[model samples]
Target: MKQIQTDFINKLGIGAFAYISISEFCGLFEYVFENILIIIKTEPKIIIWLPGIMSLILFTVIVIWGIKKFNKPIEIDTRKVLNSLIYLYFGILIAQYLFIYFGTDFLTEKYSAEFDFYNKANKGSLMLRGYLANIPILQFVVFGIILLKNRKTVANNV
Candidate 1:
């Protein structure tokens, strides 16, 4: 039981860490790559990009660490780690959507100014937003079910 708990915690921690690292790296890359014209025009100080460079370095280190930890020939499968991460991220996104659907008024009351800005910035029909938000969840669920159903066959084949 303790070992199971430890494994669960490790999976969750690694999933979150990897997700954050990936997001930061991608965001920094997009900003730097897509805004090259604006950046050159502005002639901003080199220090302006220091944080992005640091984020990229951190992301590289995380990838190296993950590769080192998981590349060994062991019973632990990287696919399992990916499944856990997908489940976790989807679960969180679903919960957030639920909160937005049901608790918007309460949140607006509690965080009047900020919530108002958020709502305005994300202006869209609730029905459309709900459909868009649910599409990936549905796809993920279908993919997850297919993976789970074929897990044994996949393992045996491997």
Candidate 2:
């Protein structure tokens, strides 16, 4: 039983770390792609959308897995974890909106005549990217807190 619990915790830790790292990488890739679009004067809608969607999917999978694998029915604080997940989702939505609002410039500058659209779109996209980049770090902190609190409880029980 003890070994099983330890294994579960370790797996959760690894999964959480991987999710955060992947999210960061996706953000970096998005940033790079945005710059490339600007430099090459190419409108890459597919490239821009892919990373965002992939990150969202990855995040969902990890969160669900963590809940199933790490959560203890008797002692785990499900409310806290759920709340954090909700907040994270909200952040993602806000980031997406900002990205779309600001990112239109890449499309407009490259393919349209609206400079104002470009300015608004690029600014929004940059802001959204920054905001989205922070989410993985926030999630890491939340998971760390959960682990620490759980450990404290276990220690108290022992």
Off by over 4 Å in 2: 43-158
lDDT of 1 by residue, 35-72 (tens): 34232333232223433444445545555455556545
Least accurate 10 contiguous residues by lDDT in model 1:
38-47
Please provide, for model 2 over 13-123, each residue's C-alpha lDDT reduced to its tens digit, 9 standing for 90 to 100: 554554554455446545545554545544444334545555555555555565556555455443454446556655655665566577655555565544333444555
**lDDT scores of the candidates, listed in order:** 0.50, 0.53
The alpha-carbon root-mean-square deviation between model 1 and the true structure, to one decimal in Å, is 12.9
Q: Which ranges of candidate 1 are over 4 A from the true structure? A: 1-21, 24-47, 77-79, 87-158
How much does each candidate deviate from the true structure in C-alpha RMSD?
Answer: 12.9, 12.3
Q: Compute each candidate's TM-score over C-alphas.
A: 0.31, 0.33
Error of 2 at 52 (Å): 3.6
